[model samples]
Target: QQPVQSPQAVILREGEDAVINCSSSKALYSVHWYRQKHGEAPVFLMILLKGGEQKGHDKISASFNEKKQQSSLYLTASQLSYSGTYFCGTDAYSGAGSYQLTFGKGTKLSVIP
Candidate 1:
């Protein structure tokens, strides 16, 4: 099943901070984070594996709690460039090498300069 993201929208001024969370009902093989700017395709942010490995863009960071089936994205000192919609995609391991991902509804963030 797809994960659920919290706080549909968030507003922040430059240099501020915010957090977007995602939770799923089923165990996941990996959790992927992506950000989409208005009128643009979603860009990869980060990925957290079930085994606790992490990978992705340099500026973005996220943490996953395997036992809780949840993940959180933290934005520090937010900037206008950070304005966008964030989504979390959960990849379920079906033990058949056919894992697939489901994305959350998304969290919209607006940052003002």
Candidate 2:
């Protein structure tokens, strides 16, 4: 099943901070965070594993809570360049020694001056 992202949209001023959340009903093997700008392909941000791993990319970070089947992305000191739609991709085992990825609807974040 696809994960669900919270705060479908958000507006932030430069230097502000924002948190985006993703949750799933089934157990997650990993959560992938990505950002896509206008008319551009999504760019990889980071990934958190089921072992409660926390990861960071520049000023952005994320944490995974396997027991809760949730993940959260943290954007610190938001910038205008950060304006984009953020998506969370959840990985699940498909029982064939492989995994499937399901992406959320995404959270749109607009950073203004």
Candidate 2 versus the native: TM-score? Answer: 0.98
lDDT of each: 0.88, 0.96
Instruction: Report clashes for each candidate as comma-separated counts.
Output: 0, 0
At residue 43, give the lDDT of candidate 1.
94
**What is the TM-score of each predicted model, taking all chains together?**
0.91, 0.98
Number of the top-ranking candidate, with lDDT as the measure: 2
lDDT for each residue of candidate 2 in 4-106, tens digit (9 for 90 to 100): 9998999999999999999999888999999999999999998888899999978999999999999999999999999999999999998879999999999
Q: What is the C-alpha RMSD of each candidate to the true structure, in Å?
A: 1.8, 0.6
What lDDT tens digits, residue by residue, belong to model 1 across residues 3-27? 9999899999998878899999998
Best by TM-score: 2
Name model 2 segments beyond 4 Å from true: none
